[model samples]
Target: METTGTRRSLAWLVGIWALTRVVLLLFVFKVYAFPGPDVTSDVSVIYQGWYEVLRTGTFPLDDVTWQYPPAAALAILSPALVFWLDYTSAFFVLCFAADLVVLLLLLYAGLRSGRTSRGAWVWVVGVPLLGPTVYARYDVMVTGVAVAALLAGARYPRVMGALTAFGAMLKVWPVLLLVAARRRGSWVWAALTAGVLAALFALAMPGAFAFLTFQRDRGTEVESLGALVFHVARQYGWDGQVLLNYGSVEFLGPYVDVVSTAALVLSGLAFGWLLVWRLRARSFHVHTLADGAFVAVLMFVTTSRVISPQYMVWLVGLAAVCLCFRESRMGVPVGLVLVASFVTVLEFPVWFSHVVASDGLGVTLLFLRNGLLILAALLAARELWRSTVPLPTPPPVPTESPRLRETSLPS
Candidate 1:
């Protein structure tokens, strides 16, 4: 059923995806060194360490760095599937596969009737913009499932719900994909799938729920929006120490708690706004599912206490889904995210020493990156609210003066 032009476009997309992925693979494989700290060390050292413990039928209960949900163990252990390769190589290969799956899903959705390949282009271009970090973390794998759930949402609510639940278990953000879901079956399936998975993890592994208690004393991360306060304060002799805590580099003294709490309060406000939007929204379209999910994730990510580089993968994935629908109007926000992603790669893994030291370059990168995110959040929220929440009918403008109508001048 594909036309010649469609086939050519699909082929070109795959070609670009292949070319970019090869570059990413080379970086992760150490054939060429990426700048600054080695990003692959997380996989080669930390993840492999976790894999050793997880393969023994237990979580890394003693390691405070083991701060992910129980289902995350699946991702850490998934490298076992390719016994032929080393752990790091296998993990990168799986990440590459996940990336391919997302692109294929976008292409399938985009090439359909009433859809556009712009979404496929977004995925192709956005992933590489974040540089090799796209494959260095497990976030891309989680994003793959999230994209699948969003694309399936319009026609298959139950499938979408199950995938949403699974993706949420893998990482917590994908549950936001259900913000605009109207089908009761989607909610029902989501609840059922989540409950079953929770029970299975709890019964199968000790400390499967331990990650929930691990984040109690976390500090504001250096790359978070709130961290700009300390970044600026450090220049004025604020005595805070940047330390690796909770598996992330964080600001750990002198009002760090205040900024972290402020981030949490902002997150609460964002949640409240989402609840209000869902209740007041009166219009819904097939595209609204993806659009709503995109906005919801944007709200939380911008307000969260940590904005790790991999977080951009989630935004890029959701943005791709939104663009798949011709009716979705998230182009501006998506473009901002793409630009911010490029900034993210610069802030991390490239000049990260500057960021850790709170230097001029670091503060500038965070300012621009976080500023773009805040703007995108505001614009996306306005667009979603205006399109779905209906205006006040503009007070019904008068066609003629009251005096003319009184004089019987009306036709």
Candidate 2:
């Protein structure tokens, strides 16, 4: 009876959160106003230069308009046929659709777990007050597909592969989940995904091969904790440049860069090592794949030169997934990642600009936020480690056959 009352209280809290979020969304649309955009981050700017290439029957290159990969351009351009130059409203539609996709994926994931209600709760609450992701960026399209693929691991992994392949075309991270899927029949499907991705990339853009070769020559900017290095280099009076060839930054302290490079390499190796461990042990489990993806996401956040705010959608969605399935005590990470997500945005667009305008308080608050995220990730890591070792496994999932399936996720 006590637990029931507590759950009712929590459910009420969730309801209020959802209600406030809805009110906020209306405020954004009607009262607050989107403020749309001025040239800086305008809708046209997103598909800015890509249109020219499409018109000319060619692909972009040489950092000209920072042309994204061929596959990404297709997504950006697809909406244009219907919405035309109005990418803003189109973006809103895309974001809304992404939310729907997330809901479907959540529902499917829950059904596989034999916990449909749990999945529904996750889907309903996982969304934010900010409306949809495509409102400001098209990354949500990729997110929808990537998350669907991973979550579908519970029911239909092959379908997951197809969806992940589509997402990898939008952004490449979904492909990494394959590394964790080593124990299941992921490799075979992953190979098919590779073929589909290649064909799509080539077909979408006439200069797909050239674009691939061109990307190898570019690098990312400093963001996330990686920005600490950039800050240090600036304090020491050094010019920073991207070294795309090595997938890192250059022109800072050669020694420091070397160390960063080494750290980055070690990180990649650790993930590879995990994959090898899973494959060799033949431990193909759904929770295992989700956990591995969590680790990979952390690594990407900590190591990447650029960490954008929207990326949090991925982490938050996955964390909700972990929570829905009651896998890995994800509530801990969900709390941490939420803080980290907001802070990343506040630091970048907020304080960085404030510092330029000589606002010390802004900078301090931003630093505090960063500190909070680091602390959260650290605590979450400790919890993750503790949760993984000799942890009580969930009950066996029921099926008509009741035989242990190769892609079993404990409970």
Candidate 3:
């Protein structure tokens, strides 16, 4: 049933994916040096260290950088599946595999009737925009799970629920995927899966929940939306010092806490807005699940205290899912996110020194990237509301009496 043009376009998508991903694999494997900071150090060093600790039947209890849920141990330890290779190499290979899985899922979803290949195109194009960082971090693996969860949401609500819970266990953001779940089974399955996973991890690992305390003293990263205030203030003699805190470079001096708190409050308000939208929504289409998730994650990521470059992976994944549905009205937001993804790379490994120094180039990149995110969030929120929430009833049109109407017509 596939047309020649469709087949050709599909081939093009596959080819582009292969080429870009091969380049990414090369960069991650150090066949080619990437610019700025070595993003792969997190895998070669931090993740390798945690893999050592996790293999000893425990989490990294002594490391402040171990700030993920207990199930993240599975990700750190996944390299053992490829024991034929060294740890770092194996990890990069697995990340590449996860990226492939995501692409295939998007392709399957996009090729079906009532779906377009825009989602596949988004994944193919957007991932490369973030450069080799796509394969350098475990976030790509988490994103793969998130994409599968969204695509499965329409027909297999329980599967969606289980995947969502598993992904949240991995990175804590995929829980937002359930924001627009219409089936009660989805919620029930999610609760049961999360509870079971939490219990198992707590029993098996020593500091399964310790990540909660690890980030208590963190500050706003230089790339976050709220950090713009400090960036500009630094230009005007703000005394805050940027330092490596809690495993990420952040502002640690005066008013940093205030900005961080404001970020948290913004996240809180975003959540409140989502709840209100859900309550007011009267429409639930197949695409609404993806659209709502896209809006929800966008709001949180934009408002978070740490807008890390890898966070763009999550946005790109959700935006791809949204585009899979022909009826989804998230095209504008998705385009903005793709652009932001490019700017994210520019701000991170491309010119990261500028970002850390809060120089003109760094500030420009962050402002452009974060501003796009803010605009995307606001626009996506608006579209979701207009699409799902019931519109106000219009006034009835007045009609003339039959006698008057007949007389006027005769005249």
Error of 3 at 131 (Å): 1.1
How do the candidates rank by TM-score, highest first?
A: 3, 1, 2
Error of 2 at 95 (Å): 1.4
Greater TM-score among 1 and 3 belongs to 3
Q: Which candidate has the highest TM-score of all?
A: 3
Q: Quote model 2's TM-score.
A: 0.72
Indicate the worst ten consecutive residues by lDDT in candidate 2.
33-42
Point out the higher-scoring one by TM-score: 1 or 2: 1
Error of 2 at 55 (Å): 5.2
Tens digit per residue, CA lDDT, model 3, 213-323 = 986767898889989999999999999898888888888788888999999999999999999999999989989999999999999999999988899999999999999
lDDT for every model? 0.93, 0.55, 0.92
List model 2 lDDT by residue over 1-411, tens digit each.
976874685566457545745543453244453322221253455465565556666666544333355567777666665556365555555555666677666655555533433544544554452233324566667767767777766567777667666677667777666655643456667668768778876776576656555444334344444445445555566555434233222324345555456546755775665555444444344466666666566655555544555566666666656655655555566666666665554544444444222245544544555565556555555554554445457999966554546447566
